[model samples]
Target: MKKFKVLSCAIATTLCLTMAPTAFAGTATKALSVNTDPSDWDRPNAGNFVASYSAGDNYIYTALEGIYWSPAQIDNYEKAYGRYLTLDLKEDGTTHSLNGYSATTTLPDPKFDFEDDQEDESSTTPGYGRNEEVEVVSRGALSDWTRYNYTANFRILNSSANPYLITYASQSIPPLYPGGDYNNVPGVNTTGPALQGEYFNNFKTSNVSSSNSTKAAKTVGILSNKVEVDTHSKSKKAKVSKAYDDITNRKQLEDYKKKHRDLLDKKTSKKDNRNQKVKEEFTVTFNTPVTAKKIKETISKHNLKASVIYARGINNLGERVTIATTELTDESLNKIINSKDYSFKGFIEIEGEGSVADLNNVQNDAEVYAVETADTESTEHDIRPMGLSWKLEELNK
Candidate 1:
């Protein structure tokens, strides 16, 4: 796989094509007429066209100006399309209302949450490191009061997994400065950092487009934005990270229970030991081959609220291993294999408020070879276990 270089600080701050100098030809020879119906603005033979307001008001004014046009024609065009050609002088989150135009709103600062890693920045002792979060944020002054264009300090995000995600929102209002030289805008319009995470080792791209149309003689434009991310992360295979065996027959089930007797009986919770309240792992045999996609769909269909942990070709001497945050009820299991000719044999780990009683409710042919409960002192696990974090790229593909 070819390694794409990370975007330079300059390009990252300015985002993409958005910061390029605005270019427009000479003013229209004939005075441009405004189509109050915005839908006609993009059609062939439209008097004058401005690609997008995102390019800022200067770009819009230049694009509509014509080299040859009488004062009457210019007045007619301005009066007709006054509402559509305007800009909000203020970029703050507050709503600004002015004469001859509806209230306008500029994009607000992007919001983010942060958690302090157990380290002190002001500890006057040697070998103490400053908090990465605070250092990155205070590196330089934010671009503007709105603070839309700033650093992307992602100390809380897992970048190597799937970096470069962007979200945007917008609302429409009547023109704020019709025929006014309002140049500055906020959000994607200003220059600032685009990718500023600790592990920004991936390629991120975005595109923005706009379209206008007339409905009930009212003008309306739809803006569409998209984000694409590509990473060099490798695909993880489905294999039991922690050693576990399949208990097929009654004797093996008994032997397995005896081997793990202390772990099942002990009440002490330890992070490294199997006594932790982590996810329950097991193996299930199906009447027919099932793909990872099918397993995911089944979980969603039944509202299981469970995830497919490890899934690939059969292993453990032909047992399909699976793990989930919640217990898989026999009722859901039966529905999953409905009319598939039951060959469902598996092992289960019951946690608080769960028991073999519900596991016994599987289909008539279903067989549960072994069952074990987690330690009494085990606490619910928040972080996913190793090899369980699925790649979003694979899921999308």
Candidate 2:
């Protein structure tokens, strides 16, 4: 029940400011590389009482500087041509693009704040009327072992000719944090106990898309490729309707009714049993096309008890992502046996051995222990563990 927190420090300004912005062509001149400075961003911690040993980095703070064009150039172009320029991230791989992350471009003008209009009353000022730097902050989590390469492209609106997509700059993002095991050397990367297993199963990042990207063209004066995953499928009601429509006679109708009644009875029985074969419909969107056989193989490789009733890829217009639908039958045993909360009747299993107070990064020799989750949840708050009782000098070698 002992509790502790490891706060991830913000990236030091000294590291960010040192890199010079790369230059591009035309009005969209300046380009910045994806920031991968390893100063303490994206560090993992134990959420609530469950610990995580997973190692991955994120581009949450990765920012791209805007155009350096003068205000007159911007106003004259907009006034004369009646069009706006936009920015887009042209990625070379599926590493970050298919993850459903979005970016926000902040206007450099002081008259309007990024979130809301600075003026109380409305004005005729177009969002991108003034030429300014566009700061695009992208939200994406990079895999520990994957490398991402991409370029910043600007779309220039042309009244007479086809719109131009100019590549301003490009960058290669390397893996900053690869999870590993210690070799008994100081300053060497090592894996901890909590990192060895999956703590929680929140494997989806689709809901994290930015709302600002929707209003970019009108307000922020930029545009980005809309990242979306279509997860639609025919409902059970549609199946029933189709079956009813196919019945042409009284005998067929009676047969369908009896089958429906049997199905309802089976479902009722399954609902009442916790260990029954429960089917869950799930959709997994990958960056590339994958066969149903491949999906089934992956499920079997993971040792999941559920059978893949059906798995098929549904992609549209050859998008960068491939959406696949799957039906899984009862895999509750994995959750029931592995999860700390459900496994031990709500008690948390600490990763390391010894007392619950000995949880630390340097506990290379500590053993595993089971601590009551209620101890930390108590109102007294007196069960907190002291931080890092390990010897500090051992890390200096």
TM-score of each: 0.20, 0.17
Give the whole-model CA lDDT for all candidates, comma-separated: 0.21, 0.21
Name every residue pair that clashes in candidate 1: 13-192, 27-66, 27-67, 28-66, 28-67, 29-68, 39-213
How big is the RMSD of model 2? 27.7
- List, residue by residue over 101-176, the lDDT tens digit for candidate 1: 0010111111111112222245433211111111001101112212111111111112123321221111112112
Steric collisions counted per model? 7, 6
lDDT of 2 by residue, 1-397 (tens): 0111111122111101111233311122122222232211111111111111111221111223322333332222222211112223321111111111212222210010111111213444422221112112211222332222221111122222221111221111111221111111234233211101110112111112221221112221112112121224222211111342244455654464344334334433544564233321111112222333443443444323221111111123221211101112222122222322111111111111121122111122122111111122233211211111011111222
Off by over 4 Å in 1: 1-198, 205-254, 257-305, 314-356, 363-372, 375-397
Given candidate 1, what's the lDDT at residue 66?
17
